[model samples]
Target: MFKVEAIADSYDQRVVDVDTGVYLEWLVTGSRYTTEVFNLVHPGGMIPFTTSREYGVDPHTGLPFLVFRFITFGSAVRAQLRTKHLINCTFTDDLAKKFWMTVAAEALVVFGSAYNGFKVPNRRYTRVEVNEKIYTLEDFGYTTSPG
Candidate 1:
């Protein structure tokens, strides 16, 4: 419910193309392209946190999650929050960013790398060919070395 409303309210509206021509001496223009899909079902926005539930203590043990097993308009929900995926934080849809990031870090660890700040990677990303392009890590952003 909240997810539907949220995406409708906020989405990606990008300009694909601008077509301009003279139609009957009148200028006709239009834009083309595609679409907002935000993983914006955040901690508190969609699913309620501990403070949002009936009581501070979670009705369902462990982390909270959205229940999509059954969709019932008037059905009674035992617990406002679901803790099914608490063991591993897989409740949200995300790219393999975490896993890939760890792999990238391994490169830095073995070869060693520097940081911009105390322990911050560089602002720019590093684009390199890996495994003969079969397993390339494109635009490895947040690099430690500038040059």
Candidate 2:
């Protein structure tokens, strides 16, 4: 398992609530990346944001954060990854690229040309039996260095 970490805004100040300022920062960052990534997708669609996002709570722990769901298609594969939990994050430059790359890889995995219409042939990936269905970047070969 990889220890994935990202810095996020606290949205607090000494006197007045700085939520607006923090949100605005995310908005600006999100807008910039939205355009850049959209260009890369080119005729594809996306709705990623630096700060603007749909909020949800963890079913078990009730931890809340912004969510950006990505469904990607690569030349050989197509897969979707949800649950890149951006908790008070500004969609930092590094992580935004990471997210984009991760989804692209997943799409390749799902496409199965690499695996030849099956799982990775060498058993490099291990499948687990879980009641809930979710795709992890690790399964598609993404690991984060410690912060």
The candidate that wins on lDDT is 2
- Give the per-residue lDDT of model 1 (tens digit) for 1-147: 000011135452211111221001001111220110111112222221110101122255443221111111111132222323211122234344333233322232222111111122322121212232311112333233222
Q: Which pairs clash inside model 2?
A: 30-50, 77-107, 77-111, 79-107
Off by over 4 Å in 1: 1-95, 114-147
| Candidate 2 lDDT, 88-144, residue by residue in tens | 123348666565444433432232221121333322232221123334335755453
Report how far residue 11 has shifted in candidate 2, in Å: 24
Every candidate's lDDT: 0.20, 0.28
The numbered model that scores best in TM-score is 2
Decoy 2 TM-score against native: 0.23
Count of clashes in candidate 2:
4
Q: Any idea what lDDT model 2 has?
A: 0.28
TM-scores, all candidates, are: 0.15, 0.23
Give the worst 10-residue stretch by lDDT in candidate 2: 20-29
